[model samples]
Target: MISKIYTIIKGTGKYIPHLRVKNEDFLNNTFYDTYGKKGEKSNQEITEKFEEITTITERRHVSKDLVTSDIAFFAAEDAIISSKIDKEKLDYIIVAHNFGDVKHDNRKSDLVPSLAARVKHKLKIQNPNCIAYDLPFGCPGWLQATIQADYYIKSGDAKQILVIGADVLSRISDPHDRDSMLYADGAGAVILEGKESDTPIGILAHTTRSDTYQFSEMLYMDTSFNPDSEHKDALFLKMNGRKLYQYALTTVPQAIQACLEKSKTPLSEIKKVLIHQANGKMDDAILKRLYALYDIKELPKDIMPMTISWLGNSSVATVPTLLDLILKDELKPHKINAGDSIVFASVGAGMNINAMVYKM
Candidate 1:
């Protein structure tokens, strides 16, 4: 039998910020609705409801001095160490983020140097052949970057690629909006490498879709709801939470099902559904609908492991960070054995959705 080259995750790493902001932390702030009016409900009531729906009780925030690229570099370093590979051997470094680097005091986005370039410089990688770049594909950015790396590896153009996702949503979050409580800061990284094998062992299949026509503005940046705030000129990340949740419910499951069918893998073989940790309720609904696709009702226990209760939503960092936790045995009772199959999926801004089917 002829050998085939496949892209497989060689190693993974994550950086969870030290500053833990709890639900009570938002109780003192005055929140405003999307309509720019003061929140009708009391801050206490709003906080409790938000926690109940999103299941995010506490989230991590980066140190006042650390920026997005700083955390990205840290995650990359951890991944490199975990992989035990020479930094010079990497053929590509793709950093996925949205707001670049925004400082605490000044909420301006600085992307001139490109976060990938900054991370490469910080890594002290002198190889000119190791191309580095950035990808800002909403929350699915990191998974999308991994897909890009898979193409390069399969094409024999890249043997090793590092994909990093880091976001400091706290700085870009609108403090006056209840959604701000869902935003967190964290970074995760994974190194994908080409492996020759007689049978497929990794990256079996993948699918992605962009629904920009009708849902282009579901998630965007705008002036804060608090018009009188000091950072009025700066754009804060905003979302039509209800609409985005609806879109994910309608499309994300289909995308994952398509990927599974493309891989010719049966539903029974999928051991895990590692999806983006956006909203806990939304994820739960999406999974139920996914099973509804096959006319199944009862969902498997522990098919999905979530960290949002403590980690919050870190945009592109969510899925990879969750993967790292399970891989390192930090996430309890969740383990990936030699033959277990898994699915990775995410949906976010750009109204984009993607899914990848992999085998251990």
Candidate 2:
């Protein structure tokens, strides 16, 4: 019989830069001066604007002194140390990033090798068989990497894997764009070890689906900064908010249901639902629909929504980052017990939807 693969989440860590940009600070310092006419707008005017639309209280940005890889390295080091696992035993490092040190090169292939080398040197692991690579799938990249790593470890190709998700959105965000307000910079890391156990806290089942027909609803590119040109905003993240919301509301539930079904677990048995920290409204909508459909009342009151009023979205790092936050709290009374389940879901650009069930 094939040895059943078990991936235990040994450790989790996250890093955010020192610099903090509050909503009021952003409006008073930049928004009004840049967008206001004639003269700078008063503080009251700025406050009014923020209150009109959903107000984002604060967000963290990578300091000018640090780069994307620096954040990733910090998180990775913390995770490795926290897990108390032998560094020499780690045989793989997988990075899920949408943006990375783009100033040096545009292609992801070029940057990943440099990052891997830096990580290997810092960790001081001299295993010649160690391998490192990158996976790009926007917000769902981390889940994809987890499944891939599990496959590698199960095949005896690797003993341990360090999965890192990092993104620096401020670098690509168009300063003049309001949509840019939704993004922040951060990194998260998780150490997974190959082990045989009846109970596993790692991935139990994961599924992904893509609808290419709606690909153009959200996108990013690099173009000139000409103010007069119609394509001036092409370089920054753009999304048809209404359409994207519709897609998310419809797909995420189905994905979660599929994951639970495949794992042979009932939705009501899940202890917590760790959905992507995308938006407060989107999350609420998804849960409401779930409650109505499944008639399950075990949903915990401690809903984790780290993205809503703070970290807009960090692309691939969202899920891992949230996981780090939960673990740092010691899991508290909200701890995920053995045999209990948690649902991880994300719906992002490319109209992609993914969900995974974890049996703790």
Candidate 3:
């Protein structure tokens, strides 16, 4: 019998911030338009309308005492303990994030040592050969890191790899911008190991694209919309929400189509789609468009389990965190069984979009 190495998930874990932020909490925020004008609508009207569109009733934010690296280490520890794998034997510690460790008081991104190195240190790994790195390709960083890990495992250079996605978006969000309510904080990690098999199982095929020429600034950072603020230099996460929604709807489905064609997996076999929880409405449109590519009108029920309504957008952490929740039976009625094919995808800053198909 012939055997081929395949990348498979050994264990998964997530750190969902205990701090739950409800939509009503933002009713007192003084939101402003892009032109520095105060919001015209009443705060109640604004919050209600925002919830109607984004379907986000609540989100999570890290505690005041914690930073990005701390949550990354927590999630990584959960994955290690769940897998019962030797932390010292890890081949790579890949952390995906945009802003580094952001402090509540300072609000400045700290990337001196790289979040991966920080996590490796906090984990107390002693292996000198275990490579640590960071991938900052916007929100798709975690999935992209997994794609890179697959390459090393396939080449026989690595047998075990730890990939984490985390971000403290609340620290970087502008309270004056309505989009601030859409951001959150959390971390999720997974351990990937190479297993010999006769057929493809994990990470069957994936595709990625960057549309920086015209769409790079769809989501960016800028000073607070409040012109009177004392901190003029502090940067906050900003977005052209309409343009970003359109851009995602235009491109994400195409990438998923390319992945499906590459894997040659029929649409009917895809049991689930774990996508970055950027926006609930936008995600619904993406799923519909994906099915439309195959010329199918009706969509499957519960095919895409979402935490965005409650978890908000934690950038890189969304997909991996959602994956962990389902893997642990915390997300009910959505389960992955052996041989079930699933699609994972995301779209975010860098104007980037990516998709991967995995068979469990």
Candidate 4:
């Protein structure tokens, strides 16, 4: 049986510090300068390459003193405020992140309880039922948390739920790798309020699939802490870009189709497609293929492809940050009506693909 509809009461976002690092800045400060000095390339050539490979023009980064939880706190506070639902009414807080406090062995799940306790205390909520927990699922974590909250609200277990996605990519990337150029840091959130209605503005249908066989495509571990190794940079994100791209191309479209089928919605009914924004070229290619498969002329103008070029990719925060940008007018004007559909799809490091269809 299908669950009843739930409304998104509010949404809030907090980006990492607004330090603008331009392409030229990278060329001048990094090893790329050596190539220029040898007369093999010019500054303009380096800048063009940076722009071509990354969608981020600028991205946020946490200061050395800050951590992932700090960013999560900021985003959660904004979501609580925007919901206009008193913090006292918040019964649950679920945070989604790929990385968290370094010292915590349990990561988000165990780390959030104390933080939630402090927040509840500061808000002066008399109820002791408020609970907090963490979920770590890479880039698709936010969507997963949203669906979980929706179920909680539908089950009449909570009134207001706060879902936050936060990550500090700068600290997780391999400093010497060229791929590290594609990472950044940021946080975003949404507040869900339970409601029963035929009107569909929140989540409609969601589907998730994972190929564990491809798990090695992306992996991270604390190798730096190994007693046998003297290298302090042992812990970092490792990804095979070529393999990841191939997986995304093969799996994401199928996921979207499955979501639409489950929702009983047709491709023609969709007004906009909000993908993971992982890469500009990949997104363009996917949309083109979709257009051909559906034989549709003139794709919707509301598609948003904004990503932090200099900041790299913030994984789970990407979708929410893009949504935040949309709400803030980064997405162009369009005709999104009550019955129109919007498809959100993500292909992340776990070799996982998630797609959801929403009626706007």
Lowest-sum lDDT 10-residue window in model 1: 226-235
TM-score of each: 0.99, 0.84, 0.99, 0.82
Question: For every model in order, what is the number of clashing pairs?
Answer: 0, 0, 0, 10
Rate residue 332 of model 2 by lDDT. 54
TM-score for candidate 1, residues paired by index: 0.99
- CA lDDT scores, all candidates in order: 0.94, 0.71, 0.94, 0.67
Question: Could you give candidate 3's per-residue lDDT for residues 195-231 as a string of tens digits?
Answer: 9998888989999999999999988889999998777
Full-model lDDT, candidate 1: 0.94
Give the backbone clash total of model 3: 0
**How far is 265's C-alpha from truth in model 1 (Å)?**
0.8
Candidate 4, after superposition: displacement of residue 207 in Å? 0.7
Whichever of 1 and 2 has more lDDT, that candidate is 1
- lDDT tens digits, residues 29-130, model 1? 988876778978998899899989999999999999999999999999999999999999999999999999999988899998999999999999999999
RMSD of each: 0.7, 4.3, 0.8, 5.0
lDDT score, candidate 4, position 290? 66
Minimal lDDT window, size 10, model 4: 29-38
lDDT of 2: 0.71
